[model samples]
Target chain A: MCDSEGSCHVLLLEDEPMILMDLEFAAEACGCNALCATSVKQAMKHLDSERPVRVGILDVNLGEGQTCEPVARELERRGIPYILHSGDLDRQNETVRSLNAQLIPKPANANHVISTAMECVGRKCG
Target chain B: MTDDEQERSRPSQAMGNPKDFDDSPERFRDENPDARFGGASEVLFEQAMAQTRMAICLCDPNKPDLPIVFANKAFRNLTGYDEAEIVGKNCRFLQGPETDPEPVRKMRQAIENEDVVVVELLNYRRDGSSFWNALHLGPIYDSEGKLKYFFGSQWDVSDVRAARAEEHYAREMARELSHRMKNMFSVISGIVNVTGRMRGIESEAQEINDRVQALGRAYETTLDDASAGRIEIGQAIRAILSPYDVGESHLRLLGNGIRVPFAAVSSIGLVLHELAANATKHGAWTRDDGLVEVDWQEKGEDEQRVVEVTWREKFGPKVTIPADAKGGSGNEIIDRLLRFSNGCIDREWHEDGLVAVARVPIWKAS
Candidate 1:
């Protein structure tokens, strides 16, 4: 029942433009439509739209001390699964860790990150 | 104010080295005008306290208020007070608004209890400049168990505290630098992927991305215990295999206590990642029921010690064995990566899946 012509809508939230484009390409490669957002506000806006975002990938730190935790909690509320991707997640990042998401560390293979998301989508759909 | 606080400056006493020194309580009081404690040891003790560079003083407890009855040259020098300004005064003259009250309270409670206590507090100099003073004070009792005096010693620890502050700042700066370094790696890989996607070189981009990630994971392993200069070989393997170990009980690690120097961690990690990526692509991890068992063992003795690590896959689909195992481009990558570690790897197909074994030489820094 997705609006993008039966294609899976994947949310890609990252501060870096290059990373966002990279994630979009990866989502496209996985046969999903990428809903890219550089900030939490835009991400929430995308979520507020009736588009079905089946899965998400969030970068923990979004520059200037901002984090993707709010988006993560929103995704959790909607029962959508996601992966926490970051480079500088301090060892004691229990607050975000409590979201129960697999951390696909930065510099991850595009296929690896996308396939992990597809696996979550499979568990939710299959 | 007590009578002790009003006591004025007196001429400094001489450090006695008399020709006919007698070790008797009778001789102790004869020449030692500063002999407050009544014992044969008072002469030696008084001379030692008076001349030694450690700031020391004695307060009379028998008086209505504990008053400083004696102040040594070092005490006067440390507090920037002459003998007269310090003697007969409770050391509180040195405490100012900058002084923390907790240590003062601790010192007061210990003095009331007649017990030994040590604390660091701010104390002002004669010019009113504050210095951190490490103060140790305790009750001194005579042979008859009577409280004779309260002994107080002082030392300025401003330099030590400053050095500690500098160390904490440097540690914080190092953490910030390391965070920036990790971000640079992420950004570099991002650029690689974004450009690689436009150029239609996704597979090539992913290969570079994985190798970068492998290097990042290895660098992170070194950070866990950088001061130790070594890490358990199993821990290094676990970090590399973490990608495939998720979602189920697919990875079985069996080895302990075998350590590897940090110099070899990245190369070893690269080799392990190469094997794990191959397995996920064409070998065992392709199925849900597949299991990858990483077993390591220590071989040889002392200088000849070598670590033999075997990656054994179980419960997977059948596959054709590569006729020339070590000659393939994939196997060549594994060999080249392990070369930095002075290690070699071999791939062999078994009944279930691919099995790769790596032997790494370990130094006898045991």
Candidate 2:
């Protein structure tokens, strides 16, 4: 599912600037190109890009009452697997429960996080 | 002192507070309640009801609109309505626009069923100020089981409701703070990750991130249950070790009920994570058939109370015991972390694998 460099294009969705930077670096380290989006609008742009997104890592809460559910649903529709990297992981949260992606709780190893998303390539995520 | 001043200094020995007696003319005005019972027992009961601080009201069901026929002095003070203004009006005058319709509906149904109903609702006073009213309404029947009147007791529970609201607010604040704390940890690790990439020290940065994540996971164990909101030593151990678990026969978690102090959870997590990584590199996890068992328990009583945990591995090649094993960096970390928390550990290189025992002090048994 990857090119000769064991590389793929990954969508990195996070509102926090520093965390986005880390995810970008992590994606690059795993030998993939990162398409970083700070807002849901930017995320949809990445999803719409012709270059195509092979996998994704999403943040749950985006502040100001926004969430990653819409982006996750679009990714699920495309059959592109994504991982949920959240600071506050509540299984009881109906939105999070319905998103149904693999969860790697926050403050986790950055490289480990991106590489796991790499492993999710071509797998059913929703 | 004058005679009036001397009498004012003395506690009132009247049958009841003279002020209450002066305000309550219901004994003379309301004949419906007196008709039901007219004995010494009824008189004594009336005296107690008249003097009590609780607001009491009796409404006659037989009257048109079921008007309030009897209201004690406290009821007048609570509603700011005198006998002239309150006696003929229905009890529904206390309800305001903000009052919830559900409780009102429940009260109506209870009255129709002739059952007792206890409700708390927003009630307004004659002065237009609102207070939470904890009201108990029930029917008072005669010897023949025919309902005579409905007695209502009211208490101002504004302070109680406010305290409960404050508790709910505190829980929300705690949840928000915990959410931010998790994000801060991630941001910190993110900084390390990006900086490490720029400095070409990605591996070292990952080691630091692993430690940070262990701390986060430890804190998360407590966050899961907001009520107790305390981490069990075994739960913290299982969370940090879960990442290293590679399918079957990897790690076994065995312990329950024994908890770690709130402050020491992260330290214990780091200590266990470091030791587990060490074992993975050179101990049991290095072998294909290897297994690691992490067990936690509480031992001793009273002054000797301590939380003891053991991390033992098996089915790996044994290595030579170093002469400077006591001075190793692993033990130094374990020692320092535990010492700050008033705890200690013992490590041994058994023939099969590495074994370490940690004893963390607990101020109070949990």
TM-score of chain B of each: 0.67, 0.71
Per-residue lDDT tens digits of candidate 2, residues B1-366? 743234333443323543332222335334543454457756655555556779988888878888887777678788887666777789999999999988899888888898999999999999999999999999998888888889899999999999999988877767787788889998998898889999999778877778787888777677645456556666777878888887757888887777656776777788888887777777888888888888888888776777788888888777677688876566677788998888888888888887889888776644
Model 1, span B1-366: residue lDDT tens: 432222112222322421111223333345335445646566666556545667887788877667787666567668787655665688888899989999999989998999999999999999889999999999988768888889999998999999999978766665665566676777778788888888989678778877787777677666656657777767777877887786859999887877777766776777778888888887789888898998889888887777888989988789787677676555788887678667887777898898888988877464
lDDT of 2 at A105: 75
Best by lDDT: 2
Candidate 1: segments with Cα more than 4 A from true spot = A1-12, A27-58, A66-84, A91-126, B1-83, B90-119, B122-131, B134-163, B224-234, B254-263, B282-308, B312-320, B339-342, B346-355, B360-366
**Separate clash counts for every candidate:** 2, 0
| Clashes by residue pair, model 1 | B4-B88, B5-B88
TM-score of chain A of each: 0.90, 0.88
lDDT of 2 at B7: 32
**lDDT values, one for every candidate:** 0.76, 0.79
